[model samples]
Target: MFRLFGFDVRVQSGFVVFMVLIVALYGSEFGWWLAGAIAVLTLLHELGHAFAARSAGADAEISLGFLAGYASYRPTRPISRARQAWISFAGPFVHISVSVAVLLAMGVNPLSRDSFDDSPASFAIWWAGPAIGLMNLIPVLPLDGGHIVNTALDRVLPGRADKPMIYFSIAATAGGAIWMFLNGYQGFGIFIAFLIIAQLQLLNATKPRPSPASPWELAGRALDADKPAKARRLLTAALSHPQPIPPTSNLSMTPARANELIDLLPDPYPHGDAGNEYVLANLLMMTGRFDAAAHYAAGSFDRHPNTLSATIVARAAAALGDHSTAIGWLRSGADAGTSDSGLAMTIDRAPELTGVRHHPDVIAIRRSLATPG
Candidate 1:
């Protein structure tokens, strides 16, 4: 790892292996000067992305690998789609610009060509920048062009564009690899195969699983953002889901905020009472409405008996200054073999529960949590 332009740049071991292989395969045409030039260009291209991201007020880190480099940007919060698109395009823009400059120099300066006559440096000057730039422009997932495509699609389609773009990357890479092999560019063909594999891994990683964010959860987000209309829309959508939707343990909003969100939902909802009630209970407790939260929670618990509902009820009762009820919930959960470590930790760390932390019953619950069933 090294720091360049205040960005942490990590060069993976595969990068050195690639450089060595390049030298070994075409050492006669790939001298030290040419190799250094390619390396410098790669770093500069990545820097373009890093600097662009930082300019956009996003924190950026870069990683350079054998065949490619990546720059990751994490904004303090979400950034505008246009700003994201600019950051994605920045690297290729810098790379292609350098390539053009090199070409123009070679065209005008007679000595520039003659000085490196018959050397690998000549090949580097002609091909390195342009090749890297063009390859990066191929629309493949995890690639700069792929990112550009996704960014554009996201602007138009929002959440519906990612999978299709990834599929496109897969098909494009496969076709490119086959074409490269048929045209005697075996090295390039193999590289595309590697890229194909990488894309496949990414696809697997992003495969749709059960997301924690139900309509109620999304509504909570909308309410937090002071957009009750959006929250209402989300809740309406949540009401449409098939019955017996499982409770989510991933509630992120506090009780106070959750109640505000619940209050915003329009009446005459179309939800299955069990799941919606449990979710509502969680929201209530998060906003410090412990008494009402406990009422909703008890009903949800009688029907569901899951770790999530139990945790919500226990935490709510404790925050309402009722350590005994909290202890009872914890004890019953443990006895029934439904309690979870994550739920226990949530209760343990809650600021509202700080008053009960050293209480004997709370310590007993903590001990129960530490012991395996």
Candidate 2:
């Protein structure tokens, strides 16, 4: 792996193996040049996407593997549909442009070439770019063109685009395979037939998927496997995720054990999310860290001011004998729940709030929550 234009480029074993196979099959020096040319062009193709993704505020890693290359990117934030389409188009755009330029410089007019009149090198290079690039523009899933089409479909139909794209890809692949076979391109036809089967699998897979587990979940697994050190590392990593989406609750470990693992960490903990703060606040409360729990809960409430955060803050404050603080938080929670039908103030019945449940201000907030709208 190396860095180019600020993006990491990883040449996988499969990439090298495939290129080596090409050389062995041809049994000549020309095969070496041909493989080298394809690798360069494919790198350039993936670079287009990497650069485009960078411009869109994403970090992209280009991985050259079997068959072709892929640019996997993680956007700093949600990318707009139009930007996604443009990013998908970028790879093929660079591919076609560079291929045409090379062909023209080699004294072969790509636009005028209906048949292959050029040398094997030019023919192979052309196929790598203009031909494959154009093919990639076809609206099929897992391909550049397919992604572009999927983005457009999503823009127009919202969340209802995946099934349509998969269905269309199946139809297109099936039809293209038939056309290839009819035109005496048996190899390409067979490839397209395989694509049809892949698309059918994709069609069947168009359903809701659970969110991937966060580092916290992994930490619990590490502990379960009797790897306390690994659990500690994962727990720390979870706190420092650039963009964390922690699970609603951890089932991997009990609150007491999780808190103990966290306490083992070295000081000056990593920056974290409100999700982490709220969850940690509860864990702190469970482990009898009332003051620390109040601090974390209050910090979370101040950042996002959600009912959940407010409830935790109130509970912590009540446990700490700060009834005034508890009452203030309960009021804020109730006020913020106007849209949720007083969900915030409905916490009067919570067992954790029993210490301050009879406080006048707390009771008033609960009365409002209990009032018929």
Candidate 3:
């Protein structure tokens, strides 16, 4: 691991192996230069992503790995879709630009070139930059272009964009691989096969599975199905599952992104709950069932009374036109063993809780949570 351009870079063993293999296969000046160009251009590609990500108020790390390099990043907050697409495009953009500049320096017109010279440096630049970069822009999974398409789909479809993109990536990669082999580009074909495998992995992650008969899982399914009654029932029925359930696979929304914590707790936050009553109540409130949500939110407070639940109940009450109930719960929440300041801030931040925000209990807790500076 090393740092470059203010970004952490980890060169994977596979990357080293790839370089050595390529050099041995060609065994000439072109081979050595090819290896060199891949290393430099791949790093530059990732750096393009890194620079753009940081400009968008994110921290990034570059990992140079097997067939490609990636820039993983975490934004201080959610990033806009346009900015995200730009970040993906930036990598390939840098590569193509460098190729163009090199062509200009060599007194070659990029458009009119019948064939690029096979001189060591020229061959390396052509192969690594324009060739690889243009390929990366292919609208398939595990490529920069694919990521651009994914970002656009996210804007148009939001949570529903995964399967479509994954399926398209799989199909396109398979077809491209077949064409590459048929047309005597076996090397490129093998690379596409690798990309197809990546798409399959993604497909598996997003694939739905039959979970054990846990109320939390059931509640989640019910929410997905838009069955509010089922959701409320499952939430109320939450008991620990008899057997441990496997963690659900993560569906990757964006490519090559890693996140870091602002603060670390002694342990990781729990991944599941028996019934997830708080979530159900919150869902109910969101779906305009304030009465049921307010009534059910008490179950969460009963099980694990905390600022989160208190805020939920108080806000639901306020939504139901019961300002007195809202105020009463807010006071009780302020007295609860959790952070008074957190409760105060919660109420203050919720637009629905405007009715209770000015209550004396809320005021006191907000003042308590406040910093002098």
Q: Which of 2 and 3 is the better model by lDDT?
A: 2
User: Per-residue lDDT tens digits of candidate 2, residues 1-373?
Assistant: 9999888999999999989987897877567767887788899999999999988989999999877699999999888988998899999999999988888888887765553345777777777768888987887977888999899888889999999888888877878777888988896754575577667778778866887876667777777798889877876666555444655644456767768666856664444666666666767777878887787777767766777777777787878888788888777777767323434333535566777777777666766764553
TM-score of 2: 0.61
Residue-level lDDT for 77 in candidate 2: 85
The lDDT per prediction is 0.73, 0.76, 0.73
Candidate 3 TM-score over all chains jointly: 0.58
Best-fitting candidate, scored by TM-score: 2
Sort by TM-score, best first. 2, 3, 1
Candidate 3 Cα deviation (angstroms), residue 161? 0.6
**For candidate 1, lDDT tens digit of each residue in 191-284?**
6767888899888978778755666677766777888889877765664454446656466666566666667766533344556666676666
Per-prediction TM-score, please?
0.55, 0.61, 0.58
Summed backbone clashes in each candidate are 6, 0, 0
> Best-fitting candidate, measured by lDDT?
2
Residue 189 of candidate 3: its Cα lDDT?
59
